[model samples]
Target chain A: MEQWRFIDFGLVDIRDMMAMDEAILKGDGDNTFFFWTPKKSIILGFFQKAEVELDLSKCKDYTITRRISGGGIAFSDDRCRQINYGVVGTIDNDLFPLDIIESYKQVCGVLIDTLVHYGLNAAFRPINDVTVDNKKISGNAQTRWEGKLLQNGTLLLDFDIEEMLRIANIPKEKFLDKKIASIREGLTWLDRELGEQRDMEEVRNVMKKKFEERFHVRLKTGTLSSNEKELTKNFLPKYYSPEWVYR
Target chain B: MEILKTKPGIHKARGGLIRSFVFVENGILKDITISGDFFLFPEEAIFKILENLKGTPVKREELLKNIEDTYAKEKIQSPGTAPSDFTESIMKALEA
Candidate 1:
C-alpha cells in the first residue's frame, strides 16, 4: 500500500504552508497531506497579476501573497471556518493518476466522496473543483515540478460572503458591476449548506478517514524534518516578496 | 502609431472564466495577455498562447484560426471556454 504521511498543522502563515509543499517536492520531505487552517489571508495564483484580480487597499487587512501553482485567488479568515488541504508527492505516486485530467478527477473525486460522507450532496466539477447545487465548495490548483506533483486546495467549512465580496472577488466587485455576479453564484460553504456549524475537529477526523480509504493508503502522523524546516525558511522570502507575488 | 488596448472581456465557460486583453500596433497583435479565474493545465501553456499571438495580424478570423489550430494541435483542454470563445473576446477588442 502507498504509505502517505499526514500532518495536521496549526495555524501558520500562508506562505509557510506553501513553502513546505515546495520543500516536500524538492525531496526534503515525503509524500504527504499537509493540513492547516491558515490565518486570515489571501494567496493568489502564480500567474495571477494582483492588480487585475485583487484590490490592494482591501489586502492591507490580510496577509497577502502568492503560491507557485496557478488557479483562482483564494482567501481565508477564521480557522474555524476553513480547512486548507495540500497533496504533495512525486509523480510516481500511486495515488495520482497518470493523465492530468484524470489526476484532477481522482483528487476531486475523493473530495466529493468526503463531502458526501458529511451528508452534503457534493459533486466533482471538471478541471479542479467540487460543487454542491452547482456552487463551488472546494477549488483546487496543481503543479508538476519535474517528477513531483503538488495539489493544494481549500475546504470551506464556512465562508463569510460579505468578507469574500469586500476583498474583491473581481467578477463580484458589485460596486463596479453588480450584474456580473458569477463568483457568489458559483461558491458555497459547508455551514451554509448544512445550516449548522459542525465541529472542525470532527469534520477533520472524518476527512482523514475518507482520504485514507480513497487512496488505499495508510496515513501516519508526520511533520517537518529539520532539513525541510530550513528549506521552508529559505523558500519563505520568495513567497513573501512583492516581486514573486506580483510576478 | 497608437498603442492599442482591448477592453477586457470575462468569458464564463464551463470550467471557469477566461479574461482576454489585447494590445495591437498597426493591425498586428503587438502583445496579448489572456488571464482569468479559469484553470489552464500546465499553467505555462498560457505563456505559449500569448507567444503564438505575437506578430499576428489582428483580424478576428485570423486570430481565431491561429488559436484554434494551436489549441487543436496542442490538445488544449479549456473546460468552459473554447478557442472560438477566445477569438470572440479578441473580436470584441478589435471592434472597440
Candidate 2:
C-alpha cells in the first residue's frame, strides 16, 4: 500500500494550487492533498473562454485566475469558503477517460460524513456537485497527468450571492428578484443552513478526520520540495498575468 | 466564405454570450473565430491560434487535435468550444 500525505495550507494563491497541479503532472511531487483559500478570487475553467463566463467590467474590482482543471467559473473569498486539492496516483486505466463521477462520489462521501458529524444534511449530486436539500454546497473539478489525478473543489462555508451574481453573468431577470429566490434555489451555505459561523480552519480539521477515516489511510504532514518552489515561482507570474487570467 | 453564427449551446441563457464563428470556404476552414465574454486564460492567444489555423481544412478530428495541442502550449484557458460542437454548428449554419 502506498502512503498518502495531507497538507493543510491555511490560505494560498489560486495560481500556486494550479502550479502544484502542473508539477505533479510533470511527476515532480508525491501524491499530496492541499487545502487553502484564494484571498477573494474567481477561477475560470480551463476550456471556458473568459469573455462568456464573466463580466469583466464587474470583475475589475477583484482578481481573477484560470484553473487548469475543467469546470465552470467559481467565486472564492475569505468568508467561510474552503478549497481542497487532492493529487493522487492513477487508479486504473480500465476506468479510462477517468471515472470522474466515481471520483467525485469518493470525495463527497468524506464531505457528507463530515457534515453529518456536525448534524447537517448533505448529499452528493450527479455530474459533480454536493448539495444540501438540492442546493449546491460544493462544486468539484478534476484533471489528469502522467497517470495521476488532481481533484479539487470548493466548499461554501457562507453565502456571497451578491458577489457571485456580480462576477458571473447571471440572467438579468434572475438578478431583479431581491429575494434572490432563483439563486438561492441553486446554492446553499453552511452559515445559512446551520445558522452559525465556521472558518476554513475548523472545516479543514473536520474534513481531515473524515478523509482519513473514509479512505482508511494515515495522512502525514509534509512540505513542498525545492523543485516545487522553483516551479511555483516560474508559474506564478504567468498565472497572474492578464494573459492567463483574462485569456 | 460562409459566416455561420449560432448559439454556443453550452451557455445559452445569457443571450448566447459565448459566440463561435467559423469561416468555411467550400467545405474548407478559411478561419475560425471564438468570441464572447467568457473568461479564458491568455485571451489573446486564442485569436492568435485561430488566425494561424485560418488556412486549415475542416476535418473534425484534425481541428480538435490541433486546437488541443495549441491550447496546451499556449495555455489558453477557455475550453472555448469543443470541436464536435464547432462542426455541428458550422454544418447547421452552412445548410441554412
Candidate 3:
C-alpha cells in the first residue's frame, strides 16, 4: 500500500482554509487528504461573478471569499454539520487515474464507500457531485495548476435549505412565486438519511478509515511544516483580501 | 475597427449558465466574451475558448463546429456546460 499524509486542521476560518489548500498544493506533499471547515462563510468559485450568483443583501451579515477552485458557490456555516475535505497531489495511475473524470470517480468512490459504511447508499453524479437518492449530498470541484491537482469537496452531515436560499440567488426570477420545497428536493444530508445527528469526530474517523481502505494507503497523520506555515501565512492576506475576492 | 457594445444573450444549460457577449462583423465573430457561473476544470479553458472563437463565423453550424473543435483540442472538461449550449447562446446573441 502506498503511504500518504493526512492532515486535519479543525474548524478554521475561510481564509486560512483557502490558504492551507494553496500551501499544500504549492509545496511538495505526498498525495494528501486534508480536511477543514470554515466557521461560517460563502465561498465563490474562481470564475463566478458574485453579483450574478448570490443574494448580496442577505449575505451582508457573513464573510465571503472566492476560492481558487472551480464550481458553483457553496454556503457553509458555524453549524458544524458538514464535513469538507480535499485531495492534493500530482496524479499517478497507481493512486488516482490520470483522466479528470476518472480521478473524480475515484475520490467520490471513497465517499460512496464511506456513506455505505454509515448505512446509507450514495452515488456520484457526473463531473463532480454525489447524490443520495438523486438529492445532492456532496459537491466537488477540481483544479490543475503548475502540474499539481486539487480536488476539494464537502459532504453534508446535515444542511439547512432555508439558510442556503438566503445566501444564494439559486431561485429563478419566477421562483419567488413558489415555495422552497423544490430546493430541498435537490439536496440532502447524511443526518437526514440516517435519521440522526452524527458527531463530527465520528465522521472524520470514518472518513479516515474509508480513505485508507479505498486508496490502499496508510495515512500517516501529520501537521503543516514550518515552510507550509510560512507559505500559508503569506497566502492568508491574499485570500482574505477584497482584492482577491472581488478580482 | 472599434467594436460596438451590444446586449449579451444568456442561456441556462443543463447544469450551469452561459452568457455570451458577441461582436459580429460581416457574419464573423470579431470578438466574443463569455462569462457565467459555469465550472470548468483547469479554469484556463475559459480563455482558450474565448481565444478560439476570435474570428469564427457566427453561423450556427459553423460556430458549433468551431466550438466543438476547440473544446476537443483543449481537452476541456466543462462538466455541466456543453459546447452546443455555448454555440446556441452565441447564435441567440447573433440573431438578436
DockQ scores for all predicted structures:
0.32, 0.12, 0.33
Residue-wise lDDT of candidate 2 within A1-247, one digit each (tens)?
3456776666776677667656655546766766766677777776555666677777775667887766666687556365555545454633223455676577677778878887877898755678887777887776666566677777778768877776776544432332455775778877788888876677778888787777666778887777877877777787778887665
Single out the weakest 10-residue window by summed lDDT for candidate 3 chain B: B1-10
Model 2's CAPRI class? incorrect
Q: Give the alpha carbon lDDT tens digit for every residue of A1-247 in model 3.
A: 6789998888888888888898888875668998887687888888766665676787886788888877777788668778899888777765676777778888888788888888777888876789887777998878777676888899998787888876775635212222335666677898889988888888888898999998888999898878888889889999888888865
**What does the lDDT read for residue A225 in candidate 1?**
88
DockQ of 1: 0.32
Candidate 2 lDDT over residue span B9-90, tens digit each: 2222221223455656786778655533333334456566676667666665666666666777886543334434444444
Give model 1's TM-score versus the native structure. Answer: 0.86
lDDT (CA) per prediction:
0.75, 0.63, 0.78
lDDT for each residue of candidate 3 in B38-91, tens digit (9 for 90 to 100): 677667777777788888877888888887887888887776678898988787
Best by DockQ: 3
**What is the TM-score (0 to 1) of candidate 3?**
0.84
- Superposed on the true interface residues, model 3 gives a C-alpha RMSD in angstroms of 4.0
Considering only chain A, what is the TM-score of each predicted structure?
A: 0.91, 0.86, 0.92
If both were scored by lDDT, which would come out higher, candidate 1 or candidate 3?
3
- Cα deviation at B35, candidate 1, in Å, is 2.8
Interface RMSD values, listed in order for every candidate: 3.8, 8.2, 4.0
